[model samples]
Target chain A: DTAVSQTPKYLVTQMGNDKSIKCEQNLGHDTMYWYKQDSKKFLKIMFSYNNKELIINETVPNRFSPKSPDKAHLNLHINSLELGDSAVYFCASSHSFGQRAYEQYFGPGTRLTVT
Target chain B: TQLLEQSPQFLSIQEGENLTVYCNSSSVFSSLQWYRQEPGEGPVLLVTVVTGGEVKKLKRLTFQFGDARKDSSLHITAAQPGDTGLYLCAGLKGSNYKLTFGKGTLLTVNP
Candidate 1:
């Protein structure tokens, strides 16, 4: 079974348009994260949710928002997408309290292209 | 902010060759992890080291944690084409769930 999965694996939109990417994990982890990988392949954290509670919000622009409806789902919504938003978005999950709490499982990334 | 810098951003070698990827940081970490990512997919965890001066071996791969817990390295022996992937090193600080990941070393193994 695919432990972590993301929907809309490829998203192509024009500038000023809005889009959303959905992510789901069956690993039963308490924490879920959203990451952005730029063209230079630098991966940076965007947001993190623990049991549907916002825990970490990096200095990302307000145009990007992350919502977790439950422990298994986390979604990212982008408003007024710009060319700089063209990159890959990845979803990850991990336990919040345990010996292996730091170990994260990532899903197939969603490639976003903002024209 | 804690940062992990990886050297030799990219490396291409023939099969049966060995290589080493280094990840260094000025800040100490409570735990360090290494991950491998292939094209069109997310990264997959390869191993985690918690203790300083610890070493773990996975088949032909050897991972070592610096004695000061501020750095780590991954060495592959007789690398094969299957070993071609982007290697990432991540560090976790005390009580912080956030993982600081390195820029990654891209390895390409040719047959």
Candidate 2:
């Protein structure tokens, strides 16, 4: 079974358009995260939610918002998509927070292209 | 902000060759993790090291955590074409579950 899965694996939209990427994990994890991998392949964490509570919010722009309806799902919504928003978005989940050996499971990733 | 820096951003070698990738950071961490990502896919965890000066082996791959918990290394013996991918190292600080990831080292094993 796919432990972590993401929908809309490929999203292509024009500038100023809005888009959303859905993510779900069956690992029964308490924490879920959203990451962005730019063209240079630098992966950076944008947001993290623990049991549907926002825990970490990096210095990302307000245009990007992450919503977790429950502990099993986390979704990212982008407003006024720009060319710089074109990158791969990955969803990840972990069992809990503050564990020394916490391992995160990642989804297949969604490639977003903002034209 | 804590940052992990991986050395030799890119490596290209022939099959059967051995290589070692380094992940270094100035800030100490409670744990370190190594991941391998293939093209068009998300990264998959290879191993996690929690103790200082700890070493773990998975077949031909060996992972070592630094004594100070600020660095780590991954050694692959007799690499095959399947080993070609992007290798990333992530560190976790005390009480912070967020991971600080390195830029990653891209390894290309040619047959």
Per-model DockQ? 0.85, 0.83
Cα error of candidate 1 at position A27, Å: 0.6
Per-candidate TM-scores read: 0.98, 0.97
Can you write out model 1's per-residue Cα lDDT over B1-111, one digit (the tens) per residue? 539999889999999999999999999999999999999999999999999999999999999999999999999999999999999999999976799999999999999
Enumerate clash totals for all models, in the order shown.
0, 0
Q: Give the lowest summed-lDDT range of ten residues in model 2 chain B.
A: B91-100
Interface RMSD of each: 0.6, 0.7
Q: Which candidate has the highest lDDT of all?
A: 1
lDDT value for candidate 1? 0.95
Q: Write the per-residue lDDT of candidate 1 for residues A1-115, one digit (tens) a residue.
A: 9999999999999999999999999998999999999987888989999989999999999999999999999999999999999999999999989788869899999999998
Error of 1 at B73 (Å): 0.5
DockQ of 2: 0.83
lDDT of 2 by residue, B1-111 (tens): 538999879999999999999999999998999999999999999999999999999999999999999999999999999999999999988756689899999999999
Provide the TM-score, chain A, model 1.
Answer: 0.98
- The TM-score that candidate 2 achieves is 0.97
